[model samples]
Target chain A: MNQRLKLFWAGVRAEFPLLIGVFPFGLIYGALALSSGLSATAAQMMSSIVFAGSSQFVTAQLVHGAAPGLVIVLTIAVVNLRHMLYSASVAPYVRNLSMRWKALLSYFLTDEAYAATIIHYEEEELTPASHWFFLGAGLSLWFTWQVSTAFGIFLGTSIPESWPLDFALPLTFIAMVVPVLKDRPVIAAALSAGLVALLAFSLPYKLGLILAALTGIIVGMLLEGKESPKEAL
Target chain B: MNIWLVMLLGGLITFGMRLSFIYLLGRFEVPETMRRALRFVPPAVLSAIVFPEVLMPSGKFDFGLDNHRFLAGIVAVLAAWWTKNTLLTILAGMAALLILQLVL
Candidate 1:
């Protein structure tokens, strides 16, 4: 097989384990979005349109309560702002590619894709085949997301309303976030964000979330700056 | 706004953010301070979102034993910190929440 195919398959292999976990979450999002008052079409489209898992779950929750569309949109943007970091991390590896390739890869970028591709990029130096690995990981996630969303929509119609599955969404976020609190800056950021969120919970349109997140980010940055000017410089 | 419109705009913004640094690389370098700041983005943003969900389930702050989500979330944090396993953390948290809800 060609080098690109080899890298693509390698990417797929690396992502396969992660997908097992993600598949169920996607299905849950689908069912929850529908039960939360989104039409089947809307729920399905959201899987592709927003593509970020946690944000989608949050959007579904807010929509269920009839929150304004603007709030949902802003929440989605904030939740996904971390993608910029991933973009920067991976940018150097793929910088040689044409604009078209960058555009295609950017569209496929998701947490899973970034996780798998970044590992590969770091482990194996950049090569023409490296982009193919990202393509494979991203496309797999994209395809699985769409299919799982559809399944969730179908399953949502049948699952009883009292299952309390909505809790899983937050649980998933905890799973993702808690493991990352490896150092003081990360811990401080999380604590500060959580405190701000509680204090600002009364804010309208879920603006508290944005404020809380920004506050946390700023806090974390400042703390890191204080700790290590060498690292910062 | 329609759901699709919201999604389209959200998707566009998301794509723009992701593309921004990728497109700008070499033309400019990310500031060192910002690079350090970026490391905190995931923890900060995710915790900001998660805290309110567990502590303020009904859009108001809740504390004490009645806050099952808060308790479960703590369980999740411990499990995640100890194990460093995403799936395990999620399962433990969900299970804790379910049991807590049942008991209370």
Candidate 2:
């Protein structure tokens, strides 16, 4: 087999584990979007359109509440603001790829894709086919998201309304974040951000979340600065 | 303000952010402060989301045994910390919530 395809397969394999967490999320998003008053068309298209998980869920909830379109758009943007960090981190690795590759990969840069791809990029030295690996991960996820969303939309009708399935979303986040809490700074970042989120929960437009995240980042950075130069270099 | 319009604008902005640094390429380097801060992004952001979901399971704050999600979330946190397995953590947490709701 070709080296590029081999690397692509490797990327897909590496991302397979993360997909376990995402599958339920796509289903939940699909179910919630329909319940949130979105048309079946809008609900399914969002998997391709916004193409984000958490933000899509938030958009559905806001739509259910009759939030203005601009507010939903702005909230989606803020919720996804973290993607810029992922972009900057992976930018150098894929800098040499063509514009077509960059644009296509960028569309699939969801939290799951970024988590898998970034780890692959950082751990494995630059290889000629590394970008293909990224493509494999991103494309596989895109396909799963679309399919799972459609399945959820179809099943939303029979799924009992009493089920607290929405809680699954945060459970996935728990799975994602917990393994990474290896040190003081990361732990502090999580704890501080969580506290602030609760304290500022009443903030309009969910500004509290953005504020809490920023504060936690600053706290983690400052604490890391004081303790060790180990992180900076 | 239409759904399609909202979707389009949201899609464009999301794509823009994902493309921002990649497009800058050789021209811009992420600053040291921002670079350091970025390390905290996942933990900070995820925690910000998780805390509210657990504490505000009903879309409002409730800190008691009756808050099934909050209680189950603690189970998930412990499961995630101990097992460090995504599937296990989610299973443990969800099981706890479902059982709690049934028993309560």
Best by TM-score: 1
Residue-wise C-alpha lDDT for candidate 1, range A35-62, written one tens digit per residue = 8889998899888877889889988888
Question: Can you give the lDDT of residue B63 in candidate 2?
Answer: 96
List residue ranges in candidate 2 displaced over 4 A: A123-125
**DockQ of predictions, in order shown:** 0.73, 0.70
Which pairs, if any, clash in model 2? none
lDDT of 2 by residue, B11-41 (tens): 9999999999898879977878777877898
For candidate 1, the chain B TM-score comes to 0.86
User: Across residues A1-233, which tens digit of lDDT does each residue of candidate 2 receive?
Assistant: 49999988998998898787677778878898898899989999999999998889878878987977888898788778789888898999989989998998899888889989998898998987889889999988998899889988999878998887777778878887899888898899999999999999888877788888888898899889889977572
Worst 10 residues of 2 chain B by lDDT: B28-37
Which predicted model would earn the best DockQ? 1
True contact recovery of candidate 2: 0.82
